[model samples]
Target: MTIDGSHAEGLGEVEFDDEKHAEDRQFVRALARGLEILRCFQPQEPLLGNRELAHRTGLPKPTVSRLTHTLVAMGLLEFLPNHEKYRLRSSVLALGYAAAATSGIVELARPIMQRVVDEHGGSFALGVRDRLSMICLIHCHSKAIFTLRMDVGSHVPMLPSAMGRGFLVGLPDHERQFLVDRLARVSRRGGQTTQEIVQRAIDEFKAQGFCASYGEWLHDILSIGAPVISHDRQVVLGLTYSAFSYATARATMNEVMGPQVRQVAAVIGDEITRLRWRP
Candidate 1:
């Protein structure tokens, strides 16, 4: 395939070892770095300078510069001529939407998730595991408070939040143990220890068949999440319903929302099983 200026721009990375990169077909680390650079442009910080991008992404300045230039050329990032800042372009959504269409969970869960959002008066989010995190697939917003700042392509860590814990609870003991060990080695962003975090998550998920988090990923937001398992009992999707405050969450659960989330998870699982997705 020919690599165009757009392709180079889309690469959005510079600090790569050619030999190491060639050794792996996935090149996951590079892909992550590139995506990180792109994601630095948010609704609030719509435009950012090279230094800002580097700070947000933890990529070196030279790497950020090269990546931004490439993205600008690719039409994914628009360079503000006089302002010397970069902003995301509409083309970025193409990649996200294409991925969603091809994903079985997104295709299967859309309607059911929408119903959950309608009944719950909150937001329903569907995600699938990608490497060490879950990438959001679909989000149906019912209230402004529950509406996610995250779009379809945002990645949530597999360690900190309820969505992550929901998936963890579905794993077999051996697999869970491995993840627990891995979690121990990772640094905590907040005050909790990794073991304490994982154990608490596992305990809650085991008890409730779902897990909830308050101010884990974002302050003032409360999220309740469950996992959608395939017929063979492998987790394929992580589902979440979230609200802005405790009062909002309490109201949602007391009304129709909590039951709807549970029901939707079961419906999604059944649909995937009917389609016979083994994994």
Candidate 2:
């Protein structure tokens, strides 16, 4: 993985040079296709017919039917009896939870996130962007108040949300623009002006050294986040802490949270450099 100049050169680009690169590519392509089918179900289109799935994935009807049937058999997708459509099932969460439970970063960050939340009295989480949304990988709830309890598979839009912005601010300009253009065209939220969103991203990259979202995605929720780095200084994932309407005081949050976020990000980078991935 490489870091880009915009965030100090964008994460150069993650390339794999495995001994079995060709074989790995085949598996990756299959996974990509499966993910594309899953992505066809969204917040709005939670259930889709075989025809719609074919249209969304650009696969033939027979192929879509077979894929959906396979997913149903695997308990990853479910059929809606009344609607005659298929939607994601709860079993998929088991896969996500198992992956995180076995992942080294999540295992390391789990305890650290708890410590940070306990010390700061705010919610903290580790997340990564999956396709167009940021998915919560691990979370430590800070307060008993109405804080965001985003589950393991909870996905949030990449713009107008602190968790997503934290990852986006460090992205290359081209990638950032791509996200902005796509969201502006297809996002299901309110009348948030694209210019405001772009300027907010720029401001986050400048002043705070992180993105701060106040009631943008969820009402009365406030969050501040920064990108977690790898040994090579690549911004690989994001770390964030959030609080309800009253828990986070504006001045105190600004003075303390930003630096703390950077500190954790640096630690993440150092840890990644020291750790090794297994085959």
Candidate 3:
């Protein structure tokens, strides 16, 4: 869904609608709005006033004020009297750490990801879908002077990034279609339509084992990614290898990095399955 006035400020907004969930008894509108407020803060733009949060969330300023107050009370946000803004607190970090530690995927994938970057001289990352974007869960980088400026918790657009495309191809058909439709409704970068971009990725994944983004997401970076799915097919994750275009040619990405990422993804999927089966 398109958020009114959100594009004018060039800030990413959370995609949510109370009307969509109004009929569902399990859906809590207040809780969802509160979470959306929290999502408005990015790693680069952490401090946000209530007015900014309202604009990003497309919620009323009064409603945002209430939610921010509640979040501060809950220790998830801290209000700065001097700056008159809110920032994520240690509680949020603790919760995030707890979730990551329990997932077991980060621990399982780190070594393999590190080995790939160490050998290939690039960056390797694992990410999962977070609403309309993919949030990095783990990252490994080579000992190079220059590398991609992204870390764990960084967000990337789903339509343009190889990691996001890899995750999209892993979804069931109907589910993928739902997200594609949503993406089409929002403003997209580059010349290609959202459907065209997504369809190309789907087709590429079918023809090859992995999806590739040759400077589509970032003008100077090249990335190749593949999906890692749980044995039960419930959880889907994306694994990616990225490097500067000058350092790695597109032919090399198509031939070497693509297959390597695909193999690493398969290994991660098997590891996740083993973890699930452990007593």
Candidate 4:
């Protein structure tokens, strides 16, 4: 399958069509639009005005004004009187805090991840796919001085990162292809499509039980990752160990870090099964 740039933007992102939604009585288009406005605010870009929200979300200016007003009234957004923009409020953080505080997997993975970091000498992260990116649920920083600028809630691209490849390779054939078709349009290597590269990564992972990223995502970062599979053979999580290339050579990563990440992934999978996580 082929994808265009627009399709790539929709991959893993929730999109709504009024025509399709009109057929379902339970579908709430207004709520969906409002949430899209709230999602526009990120840590890096905190404040956005109605015009920016309209431009980013492809909604009309009038619709953006209504949605922003509603979101602000609901406490999910706050109007910046000084800047005449809007920012995500504590309510958004509360929702994230609640989820993190209640995540049993993070609690279970903490000590094992610490051990992995102790031996591997790099930062470790456990995360799951969120559309075309992986969102870190737990991050264990390295003892070494060199590390990537990422932490919990950080978004890792699926096309280039080791963790993303591990997660994708763990998916079923149809689901994997569906996502690949969407991601291929936006992911490229040296002006060429990424299909061949991604397929090779998936093949290597299937054969070796792990995936590697030698500066594909960040030029200086090297990583090895393995997937955490559920009892039903579905990938539920991903584990990655990353460090500066100068600190750990690729050969060393393939020989040593590969096995360690695989072990940690298995331990995490076992715990998730023991806890009876369905997905």
User: Global lDDT of each model?
Assistant: 0.67, 0.68, 0.82, 0.76
Rank candidates, TM-score, best first: 3, 4, 2, 1
lDDT of 3: 0.82
- Expressed as tens digits, the lDDT of each residue in 1-279 for candidate 4 is 111122123223545567777879998889888878876665546778998888878889999999898888888889999999999889898898788877677788889988877766778888887767777788887566655546577667777788888887778878878878878765644654567767877877877778888877676788887788877674467778888888788888888877888888988888888887643
* Candidate 2, 1-279: lDDT as tens digits: 111111111111122223445665456755555666776664334679999877756777997888888889888999988999998997775665577767687766777678777787777877787766676777787656655676565566666667777877767778778867766665655566664676686686588677787777666777787777665544467677777767677666678877777777667657766775220
| Model 2 TM-score (2 dp) | 0.73
Candidate with best lDDT: 3
Better model by lDDT: candidate 1 vs candidate 3: 3
Clashing pairs in 4: none
Q: What is the lDDT of candidate 4?
A: 0.76
lDDT of 3 by residue, 9-105 (tens): 1236566887888799999889989889888877767799998888878899999999999999999999999999999999887877888888777
Which window of ten consecutive residues has the lowest lDDT sum in model 3?
A: 1-10
lDDT order, best first, reads 3, 4, 2, 1
RMSD in angstroms between candidate 2 and the native structure over all alpha carbons: 8.0
**Which candidate do you rate higher for TM-score, 1 or 2?**
2
Every model's TM-score: 0.70, 0.73, 0.90, 0.89
The lowest-lDDT stretch of 10 consecutive residues in candidate 1 is 1-10
Considering summed lDDT, which 10 consecutive residues are worst modelled in model 2?
Answer: 1-10
Superposed model 2: Cα runs more than 4 Å off: 1-35, 39-63, 73-94, 143-145, 188-196, 276-279
